[model samples]
Target: MRGFAQLLSGFLLEYVPRRRSLSENTAKSYRDSFAILLRWLADGRGIAPDDVRIEDLSRENVESFCLWLSDVRGVCAATVNVRLCALRSFASYVSFTEPAYLEWASALRAVEFSKSPSGEVEWLPVEAVNLIMESASSDAREHAMLGLLYDSGARVSEIANARRCDLRLDAPATIRLSGKGRKVRIVPLCDQVAGMASAYLAATAGAPDSPLFVNRSGKAIGRAGITYVLKKHVAAAHEADPLVVPPTTHPHALRHSKAVHLVEADVNIIYIRDFMGHSSVKTTEIYAKISSKSRQKAVEKAAANLIMGSAYGEEDKSAIMEWLRNLL
Candidate 1:
């Protein structure tokens, strides 16, 4: 019992952060999975979290928990898969401590990740993004943050962790964004975005180490803060032009919009992949697939430039037809 407590505490406190050095979001996800499992064990099995022995974490318990997540909590397949992944990771760690449970860890790991339904990638139109940016012009911080999200196509986490030192507003301005799995990438900023960032920073007058975007309390803006700014402006843009901005507009939609716009501009997909900090071109290809405007343009171009029949002359066509007739 004491050993189980030590294992859970050490895994969450030391192993995940110190050994794996995962991002805060990733750590929270792992912690959340354990918390949910603890709650389920207490509620469903009448077992307290700390009182549970290592033997209690059986293969049956894991599968039961997965079903509870889907049937009781009503979580999506992707979310269920995420919790399963966290459980599998913990099970593997347990194997290292208790060699006797090697088979148990293997059984838990054998559980398959559920398949999720494919859906169209949601992205805003150019006019919609423009309207949202215009709506945010009243607040320089919001404007700059929105512009940066669109221009750089950074994930919300990357934007939240941005610092004043990350910006380089000289000629050929760029910002360094740290993405998932601690991968850092340099994204070039457009002139408009660069100017906005410059003005906002100058007004804020923070040290290089200070957060780039702060809330009303002068504390660093979090993911929720960024989402709030985006949602507020999206509503305003919709009010101004109801048809332009969609109700589903989000900060990540700005990232998607930027990628789709780049694809529409005939930019090389590889460059877009690098610019967006995607690990693979396959991930970047979703934007090209979702760019209906670009696809329509391609169809129109092909239709407008149709060649009038084959280049063969009438005599050549006749001779071919005669040869075919004779052979028949």
Candidate 2:
């Protein structure tokens, strides 16, 4: 048990941050997974977290843990799979540090990830996005933040972590976003968004190193705070027209909207991939597929309207057919 505690500590504290060089968000996710697992074990088997032995992490227990996450906690398959991934990573670490648990690690690895359905990516249409932006016009910070989010296609964390020094408001304005794995990508800002950002910056002057967006208390805005800001404006937009924004709209929807708009503009897939900071073009391809579907729907609607609205009688149709034959 002491061995398990020490190794677990080292894996979470040292290996994850230093050796793996995972981002802070990922490290926190792993920590939360383990925390839930420990609490579950403590409740079910009456074993305190410190008293948990390495042997307790049998394949059966891990499977049951996943089931508990799904059935008891009402979490989805994707979330369960995330917890399983954390466990598998820890198991690999155990296998390397202590060869005696090699078989145990192998058993844990054998646990399968739960299959999750591929759901449609939720995104706002341009009109809806414009409505939401307009709804937040009263607040400069909210307006600028929404504009930046839609313009940059950055993950919420990247926006939350943005600093004043990262913005370049000169011609060809751009903002530097640090994404997963601490990779930095510079995304260009549109002139309208750039203007909004300029207004925001002038209103709230701070050190270059200070957070670009701050909460009312002058501290750096976190992911939750960002989400709150988005939701507040979404609610205002909803009041104007309930159909314009989904009730559960999140910040990621803006990112998706930006990608889909880029696809509609006939942007190159490679450029869109880099713009979205996606590691693979395959990730960007989803937007292309979405765009194709949207276009097909529009075309189908237009075709249906043209056919249904036409006032051609049987005689007129026959005349048109005869004309077509003659032309051919």
Candidate 3:
């Protein structure tokens, strides 16, 4: 049985030998994506890569594959979408390279994929943030770690890999994060976050190029460390409340809260994109729903305030009180 690579090499060598290499990153992405696809085809569908006919990727097969990803693998929608995208690439490849398979590839157009909702991220209220920040340990590390998330709105991967060199602490402070696909984006730090991070950096005992964040074990902070830091502080804050609220903590919520705060402040949407390292504005659209809800609440509060201060303020209130008394 021939491997998928062998088939591709044979076909390309026999026919389109003149095809130049695509961009290194693109070729790598395609290779990685398609390789997983071929493996899935052989293992899951019981079809050898060489024997995988164009019809192997029929609409039924595509739907079954998505189900298998969720049921068998327990993957989330975003992860499933990545694999589906790989299939689309294969379909696109088949369309041009193998005329016979064009219909099979085109049939993939009928397959529907559920997109992840933009509301996946939940931001806490600004009032709640004050409690969380205040709950941080006296340790500068804790302060800086928590502050950095709000200041940078960075993904977890970027935070784990953050280094001192990434910071540019002049006016309009910035830190560079190496994001997905090794893309670099500079996220400006607010003055408070910048100052906290600088103090933490100065207090840390490590090499200049060592991890910017460390845990109790004296190692660089990882996902678990980040979670631990957030949960403990959040629980403490929740316990301190006179209301005795239930503890609800999510790491990404801090990042989301930052985005929402900026949007509410009317920051330029494009600047938010650049700051957040969002490759597409669609990725940044998560705030639309949140902002709209907030706007409605603000308008309602403003209307209440206006009525309280208006000429009919007393008369209208008296009428409402009379109606309430009658109902009672």
Candidate 4:
């Protein structure tokens, strides 16, 4: 007989953080999902959010919410699936805590995840990445940020959350990145990037605990801010050469580009997985697949060009076939 508000508070404040040990970002995403759902119920079903009860979270209403998200809000399938997952997790939590709602939870869990397309991963070529870096070369802070972003292959959040103490500019320089699930990994930096980090740090000395990257206002740059910095450089690179930098270049593309480059260099898949902070090698295999496909296309194109350019006719083909048969 617990109210919806009471259950949601416990699920988000305690169960998600304490029991599940999820990160703040994940908790916030879940909270936003519920907020959207509650607003939908209030506006559509005329159910006041505060007056809503556990019984109001019926399977039909949950399914309708998914539809409304797609049709009205214009959200993508992946986003819809994330919202569904949040509700499913909340229902599961309720089932465990309040046995009386076990049936309700079961019904809610029956809701299917929205089907989402597995689109091709977008990445930039090495030349394009270098061009983007060159565009930011005039600004020391931007150059250092771009260097760490690509060399470390860290997500925007990981780079944004980095502290001054996380950097090591000594021999075999590396930076510590905190990834999802609060996992920390040390990623080595190339000599060029290491030097950039050293120079940038020396120019702007701060407390060891202070953020490694900060805005002009002396505040720690958030993920959006990092994206803005990247886009600004990307625009400059695009103006220099329209073909080099795509208009849609974003921060995650740098991470993907690093992974793709590693795959092309014949780096072991397991090593790439760990380097990219991927949870499994299966996730890392996508880069290998992309590289393989690119090679296949190149070989096919070369074979086609050779055949078309050659003067070989039926007589030339017969002679080649006879020579092959004799050798066999």
Candidate 5:
């Protein structure tokens, strides 16, 4: 029997990171999923991770592990699905490499993922966004960071990984974002954000290789650090404007605000998808559904009778008659 430990190590160390070239954060998440699975197997089946064989990974055991993640560990459906995905991916690798484990791998692959709820994206109101921007203007780093976040709509990890060389701050300024799966997309920066970023970069004496946003120690800021900066300004904005600003908002809220604002501004959905580095247009359509103008238009189309009924005879008589003709 093939040692599960060796296979697991090779999968994580060789395949995921080296072969697939996934980010360290993603690799860590996959590693953690397997760790939880191993712990469950030990507790439930008296199988140590190192001692477990390929034959132990039956469909029943895999289903039980997923159930334990939800029922015993109290993890959400999304988390369970993530674990299932990892297991399926590993099973696929095993099926290709070791023909003897093909049946077990097929069983693992047959396991279905749990259905997870799709939560609505939370975005800040325009007034609240204005207030936050105004407050951040007092601090150069915060101003630049927040401006870039709103203008580029980059993910937190992408923003954190941003280098000074990625910025094209001259005319028609743009920044290249390193997206998931090693994909790169260039997002244009608004003039206002470009100006802020230029000034902040100058003030910090940043070089082409230096991180765009760094802590006082001159190290690149992590996700937590960026979140702290956002939280600080959110608190200030909330205190300054209690009615407009939301009391609880995060960095991603700024990204969501940018997407919603773009949809409200009558920007094309395709352009927004490219700007936001979304893999699918379906992801970009969420912003359209959330836009107040889009919702208002839908409402008006639905309730046209209230406005048109009063002047139906004079204004829309020809169209109404045409519709009546068609119905008759």
Candidate 6:
């Protein structure tokens, strides 16, 4: 255990470049999975940090741990899979260098990734988005955050870690976002989002080195702080009365809603691709699923074409008619 963690950590740090390293989201995810696995081994097997051995995790234990995570802990399978992958990567690293667990590494490689996914979380419903956006208090940090999320389609963590210098005041209002893999992408900011961000920047324009948004003490925005703002004000803004039950919402749902809205507007896939800064055009393709209304409009436009052979010459029409008759 002593050698495993320390060695793996050192190697990963060496391999993953500081500036071009794993995306912030990926780092967070790997950390979470490693924590869970370390806890399970320590508590369940009574293995000390120094005494732990990779071979201690029998093939059966690896599979069992995954199932235990999903069933007992109430975690979704996708989450369980993520943890397994992280552990596997660490195990592979150990196997290559330690030689003590070469066979264990082979066993680890035998484990197959899940093919079919489970647990489908629907994006924010139309009404829910309206409720959440309207829930924010006017002229405040939360309100500005809500507008930024909807308008920019940024992740919660991104918004939480945004800096004062990230905003580009130039035309088209592009924002320089440090995405996953330390990959920086420039996302164009809409006028409304830019206006709100400008206001926020102005209010807290303390230093270029400072955070774009802060709390009372001028500290960087924390996850819980942003969640509190969203739950209290943003979602509540959706209700007819702020005191009443407001829109129940989640961070990703708002992003999904924004994508769906763009899809509905017939925005080109490539355009949305750039706006969302997705790693691949394939990921953005999901949004192209047409709504019933859009489908209906498509049918309406093609309705004239349904009058088969109308544009053909009378003889050609007769030939098409004959072909149709023969098929009948």
Off by over 4 Å in 5: 1-118, 292-294, 297-328
lDDT (10s digit) by residue, model 6, range 104-212: 8789867654432433433544555665656564755777787777777877777778887888877779666666777777777778678777777767557776777
How many clashing pairs per prediction, in order? 0, 0, 0, 0, 0, 7
* TM-score of every candidate: 0.55, 0.59, 0.55, 0.58, 0.55, 0.49
For candidate 6, the 10 contiguous residues with the lowest summed lDDT are: 238-247
- So what's the TM-score on candidate 3? 0.55
lDDT (10s digit) by residue, model 5, range 1-328: 4567777888999988887666675577679888888888888999987788777878899999999888887775645866776787789878777788888898899998675445857687678788888989988999999889888998899999999999999899999999899899999998999999998888887779889899879999999998998888887875454435555567888899999999888999999998898899999998988785445544544445535446555456556544544532
lDDT of 4 at 268: 92
Where is the poorest 10-residue window by lDDT in model 2? 239-248
lDDT tens string, model 1, 1-328? 2367888888889877777666576677789898999999999999998698776778788889988998898775646866876777787787887787789788888876655445746677798899899999888888999999999999998999999999999979999999989999999999999999988887788899999888889999999999999999887775454434544356887898899999988899999999999999999998887775446544543433343355666687666555544532
Of 3 and 6, the candidate ranking higher by TM-score: 3
List ranges where model 1 is wrong by over 4 Å.
Answer: 1-118, 292-294, 297-328
Error of 2 at 20 (Å): 56
Clashes of 4: 0
Best model per TM-score:
2
Tell me the lDDT of model 2 at 47: 85
Of candidate 3, the 10-residue stretch with the lowest lDDT total is 14-23
lDDT of 3 by residue, 22-99 (tens): 334334444555566668888987888778765677888888888887778776564565556556655665566666
* Candidate closer to the true structure by lDDT (higher is better), 4 or 6: 4
**Alpha-carbon deviation at 112 in model 3, angstroms:** 35
